[model samples]
Target: MRILITAGGTSEKIDDVRAITNHSSGKLGKAIAEAFSAEGATIDYITTKQALHPDNDEATIHLIESTADLAAKLNELMTAHRYTAVIHSMAVSDFTPESSVTIEDLQDTIAAKPDDLALALKEKVRERTEKKISSDTDHLVIVLKKNPKVIQQIKQLQPETILVGFKLLVDVPMIQLLDVAKASMEKNDADFILANDLAEISGEKHHGYLINRHHKVKEAQTKSEIAQLIKQEVLKLEEAK
Candidate 1:
């Protein structure tokens, strides 16, 4: 089987040097990739971090920078290769700035004032102004745009491809969780939706649900275990095809 997976969180640039990013360790995606590779399936991994494939020469790996870049990369790869399944595992940033500004520009704007002073006053002013500028940097706001729905994109590309989506719910009731999962699956056209309790599933431990196309649900534990379940479902679907 050929499986395409994504990992890591995209960093949205706030400035030329600063960015808005999340604390995505990329551990679950890596574990899933490794597990799929161990099963002898070819894997294509797209990630923001410098990633390593389970079998470097055998499996393809692409390092991505932003969500926009990732979307482009996924389209290119999927168009070029026929994948049996696509796993949307990355904790992608939902929002990102349309553009970024630089500190140099701000410095130039502040320094353009027509004032001459002694070297000592200049140093003091520069230091104090720089500090002020740094402190006020948080005020530099950028309008963020939502990223493209990756699962929907893949499903549109290959209607027969087994697409799996992940959802992390927080303190939501079980009924609400299922409703959200179903809606997410329908919206994304996913064959299976993996719903997990975000607070409970941290690090090496995890407990979640695997909701299939028929709305049949199964419990999953740990990242590796979930990957295995996904693999089984994918294989079954492939066989049916």
Candidate 2:
């Protein structure tokens, strides 16, 4: 069996020195990769640079930083190789900095003796051009825009691959969580969806549910247990195929 897994949180640049990202440790994805590798599957572990990964020599690792970087790597790998399954556990950023204005630009405009500082500042809000904003100012405002739904593109890229998605909620009821997970599964055409709550994850004991198309659900209490459950589901998918 061959498997591809994405783990960790994708960072979106806010400025040259700052980014917006999640707190995912990538431990679960790494564990799943190791479990599959132990079962004789070749694993391609694509992860963010900040994610925690295993030192196991059996799995090949690809490191990425930003959401664009992740998307490019995924496109390249999916086009280049065939995999039995894809586990997309990466917490992709929902919003990215649409445009960034440098403090220096506004200062320059202010120094130009414009009648209104507000109008000059508004006029200076041009499209993003530079990779890094100057750090000459003490404060800055960054405009944000919604990022593309990268997970929705997976099935389109590889119609036959088994895709697993994750839906995380914060302090929500189990029923609502399940409903959201089901919706996500349908929308992404994913074979399985892992649903979990942030409140539960913060505790010493973590809990999550694995929901499949057949309405079958498996519960796991720990990251390792969830990894095992995912591996079992992968095997089931392989057998069915």
Candidate 3:
């Protein structure tokens, strides 16, 4: 079997040196990747630095730093490779700065000034923003482009691929989880969704729930245990085929 797993939160740059990101530890995605590797499947991982899975000779890892990069890489791989499954586990940053900074571009401006590069960088960004507004071009508007939500897009590429999406809730009711999972499955076109109360399970050394297409739910406390559940489900799907 071949699988693709996306992990970690994207980092959106704020300036030449600053960025905005998330608190995702990427534990879930890493565990899924490792589990698949252990199952003797070829695994490919896309992740940021927030979570690091032990390197496996059988698996290939690709580092994705930002939301745009994540989308591009996924599209590239999905088009080029035929995988049996794709797991969308990454806590992909929902938003990124519309404008990214390049230190090299600011190098000349900073060199001409005695001031810290931060000021020069800010000025450069401001100039760019003003220039965009002056041009009266909607394309230049400093608004974030929605990154491709992976699960749905992967299903579009290969509908038969066993696509799974992760839905994290906090302190919500069980019924709520089911509802959210159902919506997520439909919205993302996932075969299944792992819904769990991160508040209740995370940092507690405990469990999560797997909500399948049938709307049936099962619980597994440890991430490794959850991996097993995923494995069984994916294998079952393959067998059915």
Count of clashes, each model: 0, 0, 2
lDDT of 1 by residue, 1-241 (tens): 7889987776776555767785467777777787778878888988876433344654577888777787899899889888888988777778876532234443554476536423323343344433222443444424456777666789888887888898878888777888899999989889889888777677678888889989999887887788778778878878998
RMSD of each: 8.4, 4.7, 9.2
Best candidate according to lDDT: 2
In model 2, the runs with Cα more than 4 Å from the true position are: 101-123, 127-139
Give every collision pair in model 3: 206-221, 207-221
Candidates by lDDT, descending order: 2, 3, 1
Q: Which residues of candidate 1, in runs, are more than 4 Å off?
A: 50-58, 99-134, 137-140
What TM-score against the true fold does each predicted structure earn? 0.79, 0.85, 0.78
Give the per-residue lDDT of model 2 (tens digit) for 1-241: 7889999998887766888887798888888888888899988888877888866586788999887888888898899889899999998888887655666666677689999765555557654455677656787766567777889878989999999999999999999999999999999899999999989885336699999998689999988899999999989878987
List runs of model 3 lying over 4 Å from the truth.
99-148
Model 1 earns a TM-score of 0.79
lDDT of 1: 0.74
Global lDDT scores for all candidate models: 0.74, 0.85, 0.75
